[model samples]
Target: MSEKVSLLTARIIDNRRVAPAHFLMTVRLPLSFATPFPGQFVMIRNDECDGPLLARPLSVYGFQRQQDHAVMDLLYRVVGQGTSLFSRMIPGEELCFFGPLGKGFSIPTGVKKVLLVAGGVGVAPLIFLLHKRLLPADGKGIMETIFYLGARTAELLTGLERLCGFCDLKICTDDGSRGYHGPVTGLLKHDIGGFDAGDTVIYACGPKPMVRAMGNLLQDAPFHCQVSLEERMACGLGACLGCAVAVRTGEGKTDYRRVCQDGPVFDLRDIVFASPAGP
Candidate 1:
């Protein structure tokens, strides 16, 4: 019940300049706060406390809900110290956000094929689960999402052309400049072929060694992957476990999960990564 702190009223719909430190701001919110799902996150602050007074989560890239006004979208990348002070905010200037914080991205009732792996700015919360229609290509739906999306060039793959009307999108770039060249787990080990594993349901975010290499390429690929992690959080909530991680059990034993309230979304065979000075 600590996840409801509205105060939106934002506005900045498009602040381009994508690449070379990247910047793509788009805001419009006012209402729509009914549990901001789809890999939820938001907890901004660029002022009202001198400067970086904590709160700068981001993600949750799209949300509409109209009937007055309710927009939630953000795709930021300026990096270092609270987004370089939110890249010197302008275009109307009035941000002091609260969240649709933590826990989200798991609405695939029944599953047919839902692969969404992102890297670099983690494609901002999988573009809010591809616009939350929950996959509806006029087929009655139970889940059929596809999106590879990677980055390292082509200006860090900014927003991928607004997600190309949801899913079945792919792109990689390490040095080839755009769309399929190298890393993106080497284009998911040469195009996973519509992903196998009984029904498919892989989800991923980014960096942490590409979400531990998409959890070791879904460990034998029977589908059902999930991951969304990034460390260095202070307290996105879960009372400062300081973004703990390292679950991995099944007699292999290794527990300690709490990336801001039990997860930043886990279960890619339940994480493990810690090493490098070993926590």
Candidate 2:
């Protein structure tokens, strides 16, 4: 860990529901803290201490650096006990957190465009990636980006309006509650052919099935692709083998990688998709 990655207490600036089941929690960090890159995560310790036992891991959604203090935001859903607990935290509450941990997405030095593929709350890290830095767009080194978001309903499209301001957005809701009436992956497949594969990159974060599905779809493609694997992680520093990903090694050999340390971000080619078409 670096000098900045300490277990620190943060003051909740705001915590509110942004969507049907999604919530946004913003905290003010110490003046010494640095903003986390996209896909990096924080371990939020429960206030009850022993009830939930371990802290919940959340990806950095957005952040802003101030003259003295910095503010970081976490966008999460009320999925289980850990997250359910976070949903109830109020402003002014002190939350213990340790983070800016884990590997993050990597954009090539020069790219024509970037396709951000998000599934529901997966929008969290991708948005952070966009806001954290700029990617080289053309030979002249400009940047261009677009988002392909998928959800079951419009209500599940968290942070859609905000993301639109940063780049072009194409939405797909299963029930046709939003922009397109098909899966988001369909949008990616439809538009990916427009750019020069060598000059384009795809950055994705979502459920395993979606990531797996994308992995399968792009396995034979020319574009460089990276996917952030989501897993139930314990001991974010990699002390325990709590979060492991199946990786392809040799001809048929398979290995496991710890998501908390080695990556939440990984090359799409290295992963062994559970489904031929992925998840």
TM-score of each: 0.33, 0.92
Clashes of each: 2, 6
List residue ranges in candidate 2 displaced over 4 A: 1-4, 135-141, 250-252, 275-279
Q: Candidate 1 on 1-279: residue-level lDDT in tens? A: 236757554666566667677676766676556557777777677664476667777767777778876766677777787887776676776676767767775745666777788887788888777666455556344566778888988777867776776567788988878889877877886778656677777788888778777767666766677777766676576787877887876787677777766667777777766555543
Cα lDDT tens digits for candidate 2, 1-279: 232575888889999999887999999988777667788898997664555778888999988888888999899998998888888888988887898888888778868788899988999999888766653233222567888989889888987755766788889988998788877887787876687887888899888778877977786787788888888887898888888788877666778888999898988888876634422
Q: CA shift at 236, candidate 2, in angstroms?
A: 0.7
* Per-model root-mean-square deviation over C-alphas: 17.3, 3.4
Candidate 1, residue 203: the lDDT equals: 80
RMSD in Å for model 1: 17.3
Poorest lDDT segment (10 consecutive residues) of candidate 1:
133-142
The TM-score, computed over Cα atoms with residue i paired to residue i, of candidate 1 is: 0.33
